[model samples]
Target: MGEEENISVVVATPLVRSQVVTLALLFLAGIVNFLDRSALSIANGPIRQQLHLSATSMGALLSAFSLAYGFAQLPIGPLLDRAGAQRMLGAGLALWSTATALTGAVLGIRSFLALRVLLGLGEAPFFPASLRIVREEFVPQQRGRAIATINISTTLGQGIAPPLLTLLLLRAGWRAMFAMIGGVGLLLAAAWLLLLRRESSVRTPPAPLAETFAGWAALFRVPAIWGLMLGFGGVNYTSWFFIAWLPAYLQTSRGISIKTSGWLAALPFLAGSLGMLLSGVLADRRVRGGAVVARVHRSQVIVGMVLSALSTLLAIRAASLAVAMACICGALLFIHFAGTSAWGYVQAASPRALVATVGSIQNFGSFMIASAAPLLTGWILDRTHAFAGSFLLCAVVALCGAASYILLVKDSLPLSEA
Candidate 1:
């Protein structure tokens, strides 16, 4: 072969293997994204000490990220509508990954807060885009499995973050830990850029910003969507609380060592993953059986929320570590149950053409308030030195989340062509 022929053969190798399938790359990207978000929870102890942050300051830092995350949804949906998920997601991945690496360099709470805000902005498009992918690629009956499978990556990533970071923190320290997360992100993002195709994000006539805003406004008119969002927000509070403060709680409240804390903290998420899978599978069954779309969604979310609330309450009172882990897992399973329903609402509620817009708004509303849960829980912990109040509050909010979906949105909305 000619010299050029040899080079062409090597170049073709990437086409053959460097780029994998679309769904596989997207899944890995989601995994890396969650890993970055959950890393803070894993490194909470060291970061708190290194910066001398108070509960409120720490809470503020956590809240800052949510603020960006929540608010970004307001506009990102429309942007995705115009630009498409593939490009938007690729850009977001690069932005957030770099921010994760930069987090290791902050010397004070201010810079850390800034970094988190930026991180939130970068990460905001991830779930929306993922949901878009599921909606576009999977058939109606298949979406639950696809969403659940993608959600699995979230739990798996979060489950892995603590144990993995715990190992890194012990050897290289927390700065190195953040840097390592950045490296993982780079690899994932490269995979995404190389492998993922544009089939899902193909563009056409744009949804006018005025009408997009108007479509979002329709959410306000419908008490059901509002209630669903409120309930979803409540669920977020509990989940994020676990992500942000569980380690600190274990270290201070339970007197568990960091190593054991990593293991313990991971347990619930593992359970949550199972719950996620079960809920999706069950939901698919319901849809296949000809259950009303809204009712199936309601049933799934309600089951999860009720389970989560009870499990959380049990977790608070449990005397033994094994009991607590068990309780937490039960709650996690319930939590995942609501998760599929919540996304299902987004899929069902939105105008088909503007599915991304509706989904984004659903998430934006929920996360806007949900984003505060971590910081709010942190503040409560710092003041009272216990998670009981925060967890209880979260429980109440979760109940509200269930009620919103069950009572408010049970009557379906009339769909308009986008």
Candidate 2:
């Protein structure tokens, strides 16, 4: 019953306009977030040469962002629960935008790492806050689609970033690219602050400090929360591999030029975006048709992870660049299908009072391991000098994620009520 207050919504006619606007804004924010991150990977080749850095050192820079993103979640979660998503996310947007702009001014490795950390900290609250907004604004049936729609922005941003950032890099250089993106972020941040203030959506009121802390304590007693964290962490290890290293892998291992790789790199992400959108529709339909929520969500994840693994393994054996790209696309499509289901479940399983807290934990867990993906991929690539080993490693990690979800997460259970 307590859970229903959060998960169930009667989509009134009057609410439609607000919901649409909210989703659109969130989608834009998602794009900006991913674009900022992906720009670094797209320009990594030039950055490495200019900085005279090894693959390992470049990997460290990438990991630094993720590490800060994950660590910030612990504190940010409580802050969001207290302060509200709109304000917190607005502040975060401004901070990260400044950090992104400042990236253009980095003088050395230390300054580079510091700014990346700041960027991570600023971006850390965006996803959890977005989930909270979706939970507050949409009915359960609509939530999956909303989550998927927003997540598609991630893929869209990734898909666009390679060619977009590469073109900018070629024209104005990497520093100018960062500055331009930062400017775009500032405009988006302003929009977020302005438009969101006008919408009247459902929100959980802040509880007393003691009561809120007590709720946080109770959350730790729920085994499913821990299980969710572990399962998602495994998935993140593989997903981050694509996010941080795919472009570089395409260029270095496949012998593609940077320009060609930029276009080719867009394929997998575009496929992933489409897959996420489909999963949203399917998951909502499944639930609306009276399928058990736990079974539907968990099964989606398990099946998706298995397919992702198989596709990735097949990618290494592909005979041509086109075939390899197709394989990677298939892999990402399945992975996003699984990822969307998992996020949908977060809303379905959480209590209304603690949705953001639960989501922050999920993000923290994923990024903790995800932070390692770049470093590990770089180390492996530096040693093996081929993409095959990295692809194989991703496949294995996806399998482990599947196993974790199957073993630890119970089918069709609302965890907050536990």
Candidate 3:
């Protein structure tokens, strides 16, 4: 389609609604999604103390969510392609919100673990659905900015969660905090369903069962698919390491008070949010100026990963708290640049019919590798009583991700092959 026709279609369609209501709702949903995800980490100290859990146990608790979220992608991807983003995401929003609210009622590790798993399953559809919308609704050149706009919520939610949840934790207690966020999510879910209720579902015609399986097998054979999976996994490992453990790291390692740690933890994520915006603008501008889609996005991811790795490595060796915080902020900023670029690349590279499938496969690999972050970090902390080792591991993973994108991901997935 021509650019003018694409613009007119977007303006006329409810799928985008001139890119106003849809993007706004998606942004809000993204923020709520991260807030719900971050609640456990924000309240980690109180929950661990009340439940009498060790670092190792807490790590396992965190991994429970990642494990479920990761595996769910295997099925959720195809389901989204078949069912549609609006229906799938709306249902996921309600389910996860209910699970988040129910978490407050858990009395022990087992119960909490179960709720976390439920939360993961509910959340598994989020990015795949969101990215599929970007692929289908936005024109190719606009997708970088669109993807980045949605992604900013991830960091923004993380940035705000510490302070917001901390205040709720102090005033109403962690249980009340969870209940409140869950309520907000339930409201958002209703709004999402209402917003998209009149729109036709975006779906491909159902293929026969054998054809569906064959399509999946073909996707598995694509070299770029594997590259995207492993590269994104490296990105998530570093990001989740911080998201899952940064606040606790501040309080335990720096001897900072819980109240102080909340604000301190927000800084890096704020930087991350800024980095995503910058990367997105740069990506779209370059692509509009006739840059190759894969080359532009791939170079951004590679550069961001390398810088993030260096920054993380430096953070672990900083001599003062200020220096450490600066380095951490830099690390987050660059990693988010990589994260946003990776998503943009996925949208630009995948066949339209397989965007969600490709994205979900990448996500599956990401969370599966990322689940190791908390578990391994906690294990290291328990034995050595330091976070330096964990940070080093993240730095290494970032470098490896850069290498994977460089060596393996070269071109878009061919529709015929897929």
Task: Show pairs that collide, candidate 2.
Answer: 294-412
Which stretches of model 1 miss by more than 4 angstroms?
Answer: 1-20, 201-218, 415-418
TM-score of 2: 0.94
Q: Residues 295-372, candidate 2: write the lDDT tens digits.
A: 677788888889999999999999998899899999999998888888877777666656677778888888888898
Writing each residue's lDDT as its tens digit, candidate 3 over 230-288 gives 89988899889999999998898888898999999999999999989999989877766
Per-residue error for 83 in candidate 1, Å, reads 2.1
Q: Provide the overall lDDT of each model, using Cα atoms, as 2-decimal numbers.
A: 0.74, 0.82, 0.86
Candidate 3, superposed: residue stretches over 4 Å from native? 1-18, 200-211
- Reference-based lDDT, residue 293, model 2: 55
State candidate 1's TM-score: 0.90
Best by lDDT: 3
1 or 3, greater by TM-score: 3
Candidate 3 residue-wise lDDT at 37: 92
lDDT for model 2: 0.82
The predicted structure with the larger lDDT, 1 or 3, is 3
Q: Which ten residues in a row have the lowest lDDT in candidate 2?
A: 1-10
Look at candidate 2 and tell me the lDDT of residue 210: 13
